[model samples]
Target: MDTAILPLGTVIRRQADSDEQAIRLWLHGKSAHSQRAYTSDIERLRSFVVRPLPQITLDDLQGFADSLADLAPASQKRTLAAAKSLITFSFKIGYSTFNVGAALTVRKPKNTLAERILSHEDITRIIEREDNPRNHAILRALYETGCRVSELCGLKWRDVQPRDGGLAQVTIFGKGGKTRHVLVSQRLHEELCRLRGSSGTDAPVFPSKSGRALDQPAVFRVIQGAAKGAGIEQRVSPHWFRHAAASHALDNGAPISLVKEQLGHSSLEVTSVYVHARPTDGLFKFLNR
Candidate 1:
């Protein structure tokens, strides 16, 4: 740690003095997913700006943004945002005298939520096509819970408990260390119980053949293979199930607030994207053919 004295007799506490140290301090409390994404984004910035944190100028930031022209808008935005976060943190920690990231404008990215959503029939087909019990449960729980794939992968047997009327409640550890309870149907509950067998409470709800907790990539392959087997030509990922769950629930008249809590959304506006993406009714409905 270091300290700096200003002309006005003000002293600033410095937690980090270099770019690498600043990045580490910035990512200290972030989730694993965020840490990985932000690290990759910072790496992209390093590739463009070959200078120290304090030496980076607005011109360097702008040039880095320009070099991202080859990437998609979303990627560009995310990378720039990560750089901004890092540079901002560096300024806060007295590593840099100026917050150059503040001057760097991040362009808005395209919204492809609608294109990623799958229909009810497609979701059902993919689930039915999976013959493996573990993979089948994974697909069902993903759609049924509307949980992130990371949350599902980290599920533990102790997190699931039998509920009233043969239903079951699952406690999902979501983003930012938030936990939410989701109720599954009786059939799903039974399926999970059967899958649990004699495993201990600390055991993962979904385990690989080696008896370890299933990883995200393996679950992705499970869903992709199932989708292809069901004749879905387009690329399918575990996230599509989450999107489909939100859209389908909203389409069937489920309240947006309920969906928000179930999905662990931080805001109603985040949950409202599904309604906006797939509006069931509009002025076109009243048009006479």
Candidate 2:
């Protein structure tokens, strides 16, 4: 018997000799959104665990997890999960003799999707209030397509095309390098065409004044401004449109499975959360006086 633990040849082409190199390799293939999020999460972990990667013990991770008590449950989970992933990657690359984070487990956070969902009326008010052609189109695209802010920001005119009956379709390069095609409403299709004008197909569908793609932060500001202008008291983000899209779709009889594909959800279970959040038929309704 070869008693030694062989390197994971399939996972990586070579061993990561240092923690820094291992960290780079771990984030190498992730989407930009994930890379940014995981970087912040890892940075939070680093502040607590000062020791080198291989030298860190379970106690260190436990203390790090403990430090996250002040953060919201979702934030805590994201931070701890990032640390566990990093340590596990280091171990897999043979940089660490043991996976220090393997024993540490972060509990799943409570679902808050219901709280974030915007009513269709609220969504309409926001869109109807935005007078700028570009911003108006942005709001509609986000709502009608149910795309993530990152996906919307990264969208190019080339990714959109005419389908049958004046409807347009979008090829979204979503998370984990997955590709999903979502149908665009005919109204939105015409709006996008009007916005495109003379711009090249390679140009971003939503471009800044500098002719660059509208980044996520800019899109966020657009959502916030629109929501505020619409007299919405609650804070709004680009994701509100996504939630509204899912919820409103299910409310209007769109199939859950279809919503799953449009949103590029990993599983039917993920798509089902929208249904669960706003269940159409409930026993409580039957008990109404």
Among the numbered candidates, top TM-score falls to 1
Clashing pairs in 2: none
Residue 255, candidate 1: alpha-carbon lDDT: 92
TM per candidate: 0.94, 0.93
Q: Model 2: which ten-residue window has the lowest total lDDT?
A: 1-10
- Show where candidate 2 strays beyond 4 Å: 1-14, 283-289
In model 1, the worst 10-residue window by lDDT is 1-10
- Model 2 — TM-score against the truth? 0.93
Q: Give the whole-model CA lDDT for all candidates, comma-separated.
A: 0.90, 0.89
